[model samples]
Target: MEKQFTLRKNEDFKRVYKKSKHYYNRDFTVLVKNNGVNRPRIGFSISKKVGKAHQRNKLKRRLRSIVYNNYRYINNVDIIIIPKKHTTDFTYDKLKSSLGHVLNKAFKEKKINYVK
Candidate 1:
């Protein structure tokens, strides 16, 4: 499937991290912000704290798969899924379950009448 969204730049990440509200549930952190578009774009952040470059990239690929699998149902806010320090040992099933629960919760907590 196509990458329906683009990752945010370091500057954009800083701006949103400062201004946007967030939620955390052990597995990931979801940051939501209105991009004034019809559909929201999503991004992921896997820091060096997670592991070495190999481990970090592996987790990044895993998280991207989670988002790609459900791209159609989710869209209109910039979302950044951060893999936690504990996620380095994540199994496929574990990651899937975590992504499903957290992604849904992020949307659930979002304002229903948000402007594009």
Candidate 2:
């Protein structure tokens, strides 16, 4: 992903939270919205309620990996993945599954095309 396309500030998160389309699954939340920009972007928020610093970092790593792995093939949407408390103990497979599953559900609900 391009550096400039990333969502990085408190205000950006607030905007997405307020204005974006959101979807949720048992273990993940996927928020997406068209910002009318030409590029796709991403950000992550793993809360302290999920665990201590180590667990939070782990969750971020999981999300970053999943996003990077799939970023190239996705459409130009701004994505923010918020990991809930249940996400802390997730394995790689679980994380991938949760992300993919929830994102697909979200896409379906919004009628967004996701090329496999």
Candidate 3:
């Protein structure tokens, strides 16, 4: 994801966590909030309990690729993704599908139109 499309500030993540509507599946918990911007912004919260530093970094990279690939289909919102502990064993495709499922569920309820 591009720098402008990423949530980098601590306050930004906190705001999304406290105020956004949440969606969950086995692999991920997604928080979504309208940001009143033209494009969407995303952040990932992978805790130390999930894995070691290298593993966490790798997971973030995979997620970033998935989001980047589907950027055009996303609405103008702030999204924070929290990967569950079970994801430590997930393959790239599994991770991608899991996140996609949660995102679709969240956006669908909000009446946001986006191509899958």
Candidate 4:
């Protein structure tokens, strides 16, 4: 992901976690907050509990790909995705579908306000 489309500062993540709405599943969790920007920004976190450094990095890549492919469907929010212990076990396709499912559900419930 591009730097402009990511949450880089510690404060940014903290602000999102403070009052952001969230969605959870066995594989991952998503926290979202209205950013008031024209486009959505995203961040990913994978702890050592999930796996070693390399495994975690691989999972991050898969998750980023899911976001990238679905970029148009998302809008104007800052989102953070945290993988669970078993997330690394999922194939890329499964991961993508699961993320999409959660995001769509949030939209349906009006948790994430759409832009355009």
Per-model TM-score versus the true fold: 0.82, 0.86, 0.92, 0.89
**Best of the two (2, 3) by lDDT:** 3
**Residue 13 in model 4: shift from native, Å?**
0.1
Expressed as tens digits, the lDDT of each residue in 19-116 for candidate 3 is 99989998899999999989899999999999999889988898888888887877679999899877878898888888888888898866654324
Task: Extract clashing residue pairs from model 2.
Answer: none
Candidate 4, pairs of clashing residues: none
Per-residue alpha-carbon lDDT of model 2 for 10-58, expressed as tens digits? 8888888889888998888889987777777888877779999988887
Best by TM-score: 3
Rank by TM-score (best first): 3, 4, 2, 1
| Residue 116, model 4, lDDT | 20
Name the runs in model 4 displaced over 4 angstroms: 110-116
Across 2-114, the per-residue lDDT of candidate 4 in tens digits comes to: 77888889999999999799988766688989999988889987789999889998998888877776666667789998888987889987888777776765676665533
Quantify all predictions' global Cα lDDT against the true fold: 0.72, 0.78, 0.86, 0.81
Better of 2 and 4 by TM-score: 4
User: Model 2, stretches more than 4 Å misplaced?
Assistant: 109-116
Please write out the lDDT profile of model 1 over residues 1-116, one tens digit for every residue: 25447655777677667777687788888787766666657777888888899998888888777667676665556777777899989897798887777666667754331211
Q: In model 1, what is the error at residue 48, expressed in angstroms?
A: 0.9
lDDT of 2 at 57: 82
Q: Relative to the unseen true structure, what is the Cα RMSD of model 4? A: 3.1
